[model samples]
Target: MPTFTINGISATVPDGTTILAAAIRIGVEIPHYCYHPKLSIAGNCRMCLVEVEKFPKLQIACNTVVTEGMVVRTDTEKIRKAVTGVLELMLIHHPVDCPICDQAGECGLQNYYMKYGLHKSRYDLEDKVRKKKVQDIGGMIVLDAERCILCSRCIRFLREVSKTCEMEFFQRGDHSEISIFPGRKLDNYYTGNLADICPVGALTNKDFRFKCRVWFLSSFDSVCTGCANGCNVLADFKGDILYRLKPRRNDAVNQTWMCDFGRLEYRKANEARLLVPVLRENGKAAAAAWEGVLSTTALRLRDIADNEGPDAVAVIASPRSSNEELFLAKKLAAEVLKTENIGFTSRTPGDRTSDDFLIKGDKNPNSTGAQLLGITEEGFGRVVKAISDRKIRALLVFGSELSDFPDSQVEALLSNVPFVAQVGTNEGVVSRVANAVLPSASFAERGGTFTNFTGRVQRFSQGFPPRGKAMNEIEILAGLANRMGADWKFDGEASVFRALAASSAPFAGMSYESLGSEGQVVAEGRK
Candidate 1:
């Protein structure tokens, strides 16, 4: 460790640790726009200038490596003057559009200006150089050159982190602006990241352009359900409406970034939502209450299991469901329904593409969680075959559309069953063909844990109450099990997870508090 004193506070950091990273370790804030720890240092922004002993001048904290016995002072008057001058230059041609900017509340330039540069403009605002205005860039990003400070965070992120060299600076000096390469668009799987790393309002997401102000949105820690990687994210929503999903740093998993596909999966929670439970009445759908839906579903499931045997009633679980929900589903199948004919979601639609990076071909977020609970995808085919043969007379599907099977084929196969109950977040082919549809809360509205592809269990909090009449999947499953004469009293996700941890050997000694924010990797090999 290299011992150093930053602003008179001592910190001992590892070898080759930069001054900024050392400052972070000691909880000292060294403000900079282009100094993202995950990316290569560009050293273009002088916002992190700090006075160091025995140095002729202030050093940029991002590039300056700490050494043994090194002494650094960041709050000196000399450093303040230097940083104020740098901020003045950065704002010379930058537009004062903070009133309408989406990044206003959380923008680096705006925050830094209030702190350091409150100086009046030397020249007329009208005389400042104007670059391109709101120009539509592909991959769901809208670029506003006038708001750019040329810190190169987005440029560096594209070249270094994403490794997609599609964006570059064009023209000279005041005219220099970020643009995509000719005849090519910024069409990568991780384009949303550019907007996330943009220090200013230059790069903005089109989906979240003017939808809601940052201050008005309530954010909760959540995991991305778009893929098996289970990237951590902040679910921003308000009044039953999910606004957006922003990547939350988890170095063990997504590492400060996530794919654009996962970023846009917030739409599943916001759009085409199933708000109420439904029961088919003579081939037509009718709105149903929780009591009717659960009672009818329980009675039918029991009748099928008793009349046609336990093998005739099948339950299709989903990786999209939480570990608690899956555990209850299995318990419902084995204890209440007394059936071993259980299947799980194998593949999801549009989950076929992948890269060596974060993208996983298996889009289900909790497949590994399902696996840890002894639920495998191998039985899904068998269940489908039974459905086709009309041998499985009753079915309960818990999930969204977490399979790649054709909607028509799913409807055709499900049609053979006399009592099909779909318990899911969205209305799809399975819901359409089901005799009873139970509206279950989406992932954002459910406090649950999703074990990623690597068996890392991460917990996500519920952003808000479920939209309309939809209930948490765990609640629905537990209620139905209780109705079937199985005692299930779960306080919340934690209670069921404790049961899971106790029952599953691989997940032993793990709980929500133990999982924490970064999450814990499961013990290798299962029970």
Candidate 2:
């Protein structure tokens, strides 16, 4: 440990911690733009200047590591003046477009300008640098050269993080601007990150352009359902409309970034979502209420179990579901419905390694969560074998587009099940085979937690209402279990999580409240 004084307050931190981080720890904020916690130190923006005792001049706090008995002052008059000067210099080339800019509300430049740049400009506004506008950087990102401060944050992000050196600074001096290599585009897996780190409106997301104003968009702490990595996120929405998705900081999971696929998954809610619960009775589909669906499904399940025994009833769980939902599905099969035939499905085929970056080979969100509950892909195969052997009659399937299976083995298993009850948001192969399809909420519309590949349990809250009358999968499962006259130990999603945490040795002391927005990683033996 190293002891240092930040703005007159003395404290001890890890040896390699930077001065800016120390200031943040002590609540003395130093304004910065290009210094991201997850990225390498760039020291390009002089906004983080701090006066150090015994040093000849002010040092960039982000690049300057704290040493034993080092003294740093960020709120001194000299430091503030230096930071103000840097801000003024940065704004000389920056366009005055905050009113129409996408990053106005949450931009680093805007925040820093208000905090450190209160002085009226003595520089001639007519002499400010002006360049091209609305230049397409790639499929998703659009660039406005006039608004760029040339901090080189985006350029450094592409080269260092994405390792895709597609972005570079072109030209020289006042004409220098961020551009891609000849004939290359910023079409990497994590290209959406540029929009998040732009500091200003120099780069904007084409998909999120002209959408709802960010201030009107309310945010919900959530997790990405796009992959098994389960990256933490904040879903921004207003009323029933979803606006955008932003990454929440989680050092154990995705760090400070999420994949483009996870970011664009919001558009999925705008189309083909099951808004209301529907029950097909006597070959006629009719709209139903929550009570009607649960009561009816419970009776039907009981009838099947009485006639065909527990072995004849099968339950299929989705990796897309939360740990609570999957655990409830299992309980419905083994306790309420009295069935041992349970299956867990995932879409990742055979790939399951982590790249140590954004893209995880496992495509589903909670495959490891299912594994924690003792449900594996191989366990699902046993159910398929039973279906093929004509031993299973009634099947309750969760998520996955069944139509994608056209002529596959899984399709054959589903087709053979006489009473196929499908519960999910999308209508696909399961819809074609099911006699009853209960509309369930998508990840965005529900509040739940998922365990990622690394056994890190994360929670995501509801961003918006379900499309129509759709119920959360956890709520639906719990409701059905209640209607079946079975004593369910849990009621709310958080309540069930206690049992999940208690039963699973890995997550022994974990709770929904403990997870909070940041989440916790399950240790080796504990997980």
Candidate 3:
């Protein structure tokens, strides 16, 4: 351990810890750029200057390792002047268009200007060096050369992290700018991270360029359900609309980076949605009230199980649902529906290709949770065979899992099955095939936990309310369970998780309080 004094505060940190990191640990702020913890240090940005005792000149805090008994001063008059000078030099050639830049409220230059550099401009707009602006760089990113601060964070990220060396510095000194090399452009699925690492408006996301201001959007900690990797994210929304999902730092999962596919998954909560419950009438589907839908659904399932047999009913749970929701679904099938013939569909309905970085090939976030809750993935074919044989008197399907089946086969099963009910988030094949369609909430509209591919259980909160007459899976399942003569009660997701922890052996002793922002991995040593 290295003990040091920073701004008159004594602190001890691990060996090789930088002054900037030590300051951050002790609740001190040292302004910096181009010094991301994940990327290699480029020491070009001298904004984190600090005064070390017995040293003639100030040193940059980012690359300055703290030695034992070393004295550091970050809040001195000398540091303030040095930082101000560095900020002025960086801003001399930068554009003054913060009003139009999409990174307005969150830009590093805009924030540092208010803190350090308020000096009157010594050079006018015409006197500053000019560079290219609004160059359409490949991979959903727009580049403005005039606003780049020559930080080289984006350039280094490509060379080191993504291993796709497409961007580089063009000229020398003030005329230098970031650009893709000739005859090549960014063609990777991880290009969206370039905008996140850039400290200024040089690289902006084309999908979210002018949509909404950062000040108007509120952020909530969430886990991405795009795949089994379960990358952490910050859901940015306003009112009932989710604008974006930015990567949240989780060292065990996605460390401050997510693929482009996961970034756009938020659109499912905002567009082409199902709003109300629809009941089949005279071979036609019609929008109906929740009360009638629940009662009718319960009556049909109960009468069939009592008449034909427990094996006459089948359930197709979804891996896209949460742990609590899946537990309730399994309970609804075993206790109320009284059938061991319950399973979830294994084949997903997306681009199943994955990379070595952050994406997973399963394309489902909760398959591990579904399996832990006693739902088999191999029974989809058996359930389909039962429906084909006309032995399934009543069928319950969650999500649009049937949509991934062959259209001719799906239609034949829907026609042969006596009664079909679906709980879906959006209108797709289920709207046409199922005899009754119940609207359920998307991932962003409900709060629950999802177990990733490695058996790591993470918690995500609801960012949007259920649109129109839609309800979450827990509420809808509980309603049907009670209507079917099964006594069930749950206050919220917390209570449901508590119930899940008690019943499931793998998730024996865990709660929402224990699984805070960063989640706890399931399996061994989880007390």
lDDT of 2: 0.80
Per-prediction count of colliding residue pairs?
0, 3, 0
TM-score of each: 0.97, 0.92, 0.97
Q: Which ranges in model 2 have alpha carbons more than 4 Å from their true place? A: 122-126, 348-356, 407-415, 516-518, 521-527
Q: Please give the CA lDDT of all the candidate structures.
A: 0.87, 0.80, 0.87
lDDT value, residue 21 of candidate 3? 84
**Model 3 over residues 139-173: C-alpha lDDT tens digits?**
87989989999889999889888898899999897
- Candidate 2 per-residue lDDT, tens place, 36-127, comes to 88778888888889888999999999999999999888888998888899988877777788898987788888888888898777778788
RMSD for each model, in Å, please? 1.5, 2.8, 1.6
Task: State the displacement of the C-alpha of residue 105, model 1, in Å, after optimal TM-score superposition.
Answer: 1.2
Error of 2 at 122 (Å): 4.2
